[model samples]
Target: MKLSDRQEKIIDLVRVGQPVTSVALADKLGVTRAALRADLAILTMIGTLDARPKVGYVYSDKPKRNLLLDYISDIKVSEIMSKPAVISESTMVYDAIVYLFLNDVGTVFVENNGNLVGAASRKDFLKISIGGTDIHKVPVGIIMTRMPNIICGRADDSAYEIASKIIEHEIDSIPIVETLKVDGDKEQYKIIGKVSKTNITKLFVKMGKSK
Candidate 1:
């Protein structure tokens, strides 16, 4: 990785000073410690610098491009996924809509016999609600996007995988599911959680707040 002029300067400073603190570096650069944080984090992440408790920063002499695992890619779906709002496929569309609002989620997963069967979005509920059809009478299953059509991910999946699928599928949420073997050894999906736009945003916000 090509070092920025500031990064090169940081290296020079650390090499000469040995164990310099962020406060001292900020003073020398005529910038606040906050301004130096990103640079220092990058430098530390790429093994260009080492941070010690109380002792401060030191030159590590590591290759700048030793970038192996990026932080975002290292985050798994299980870490960021939220509890899914699930409803029985037999549930009335109006009841399903109520559950969606109660959970404050964009999409609701539908399950039958403990196995995920389908999914319905807020738009689906809204469309059915406004149509001539009586939402109170219609089963959510009738309007649901059936399983195998609804995109899903596993707990072990990377957050990046979920994000890419969300963009490509143009869906607001993706259910996190697991395989269930039923009678005759038939495979089924068991809905456990969901990853939504809000979940992603919360993860990023939490990451930003972290050291």
Candidate 2:
């Protein structure tokens, strides 16, 4: 969910060690405590605000700015990335279907031996299911598009780079594949997170404020 100007102010206020009580938030936002509570609920649901007893909401620890933002704004992949939706290559199509529906996300990354191997979109699963294929019998690997050609991202990559890739490739999300070095050997790729269009949109909102 996109945050509003008031919501951003609330987050900033909370970050600066200000009281985030609904009454305080309401006063700052020029809204009723009831309205501020509603706003806080949304932020809490999206993992932005911490729920407390009477102390009210608190912002999650703010991320530190880097050299990238010296040229750009306060936008980073951490601020924009979505909770990863990863599955093993051996995952059943039925499982993928359930995850997609439950998470309301359209794509899932496929892992093999703890490394990224492929990705499957909702369209891939839908096409197979619609073609009368038994989901329980279909491994996601059968329909997944493999890596090497797949687009990916690094965790520390700037939001601008992520956004550019999303626009350039016309993809819904980008997997954040971390490199694993075993026994001091060469780095191998493994997906650890994911960033999506929705995430980029949030970054845009945050950057708009910093400007």
* TM-score of every prediction relative to native: 0.69, 0.61
Candidate 2 clashing pairs, residues 3+ apart or interchain: none
For residues 145-201, what per-residue lDDT tens digits would candidate 1 score against the true structure?
997899999999998789889999999999999998888799999988999988888
Stretches > 4 Å off in candidate 1: 1-69
How good is model 1 by TM-score?
Answer: 0.69
Candidate 2 contains a number of clashing pairs equal to: 0
Clash pairs (backbone) in predicted model 1: none
Candidate 1 shows a clash count of 0
Candidate lDDT scores, in order, read 0.90, 0.79
Instruction: Give the winner by lDDT.
Output: 1
Tens-digit lDDT track of model 2 for 13-123: 887764467777778777888877777876776667776778877776532333335645445676667777888888899998898888888798888778888988877
